[model samples]
Target: MMFRRTAFTVGLLALASSMYSHAEKVEWSQGSGQSDGIVVSDGANNNARTAYLSISSAISVPAIKKTQEEVSTLKRELAEVQRNAEEMKRQLSTQQNQAASGLKDSSANLSKEIDDLKRENQSLKSALDDVKRQQSQTASSGSSNSSNVSREMDGLKRSVEELSRENDKLSSSNDRLSQRLNDMDRSLSSLESKVK
Candidate 1:
């Protein structure tokens, strides 16, 4: 996934650079009131008169009619394009809103999951502490009156060792859970960047 994202970004950058390099710079001539902007041509060919027209006076009517029709067609196409653009904008906005809503929901869920995990961790810690306290009380009480102090010390030591083992197991499990959560976060972030 990471490799794919990197490749895509590289490809897009290369395409953008190529497009920029290939772009043409159009420089218009300064000539004004002309064909492409030239004014006074007393010859047969001029911007104002077409080759097909018989009389110069006929120029205005046919040309004007044609211009009006072209304008009408262009206006219709423009309206259609504008309507499509508006529809696209609306769709984009709706999709963005949905994405935001989904993000918010996921964030809330992640926060809740973290909180729940923390609460469970605290509960486990409290339970472990209580067990240690109970063991200490039991060992101390028996040691005060018993002749087998060595055996009591050995038992206490064994209990402490067992508690240490439990703590190590819990720690490893927590570490694994944390790594899994980090991996999930990375995946989600990668997905979000791609969507953008």
Candidate 2:
């Protein structure tokens, strides 16, 4: 019985091999003018054991082309957006640097002016003290010279008041510039976060 089973299996394999050898792949044209199909046929029979496989029907060429075009356009749009973002970043950096430079220069100038004003104020105060000492020493001489000393003292007081007012104005300006710098920093940070 084992020998008979082996002989039957060998016969079946031989038949399969013969059929496989006789199989032919032919191009099948469609009546609707579509793409050609592959028809695997057995040469032993014209109508038996035929397989029709249409690759174009399974995958539409026009759909594939449209998808490819859409992907290309999307890539181009993404690249353009990236370029615009980079340009905006560069401009923002330039503006930030320029603003910082201007602020530094203005702050330096204001500081120098304040220092100069303080020194001048100190000099004026010293001169007024000297005049007071002179007035005290010569008070025994006359009333007219005392009046002149008082007028000089009054003029020095007015000058001191004016310098104080100007110093206050510069301090206020420096405060405003500092506030602007803080605001710009916050804005730049927010923009950088959004870009990331």
Write down the RMSD of candidate 1 (Cα, Å).
Answer: 23.3
| Candidate maximizing TM-score | 2
Each model's lDDT: 0.59, 0.61
TM-score attained by model 2: 0.54
Give per-residue lDDT, candidate 1, residue 40: 20
What TM-score against the true fold does each predicted structure earn?
0.48, 0.54
Model 2 per-residue lDDT tens digits across residues 1-196:
5566556655654565565675554334453444554334455566545333344444467988999999999999999999999999998887766666665666566556656655665665666566556555555556677678678667656765665666566556656655665665566566455544
The TM-score of candidate 1 is 0.48
Model 1 Cα shift for residue 81 (angstroms): 1.4
The numbered model that scores best in lDDT is 2
Please state the error at residue 32 of candidate 2 in Å: 9.3
Backbone clashes for every candidate come to 4, 0
Which 10 consecutive positions of candidate 1 have the poorest summed lDDT? 46-55
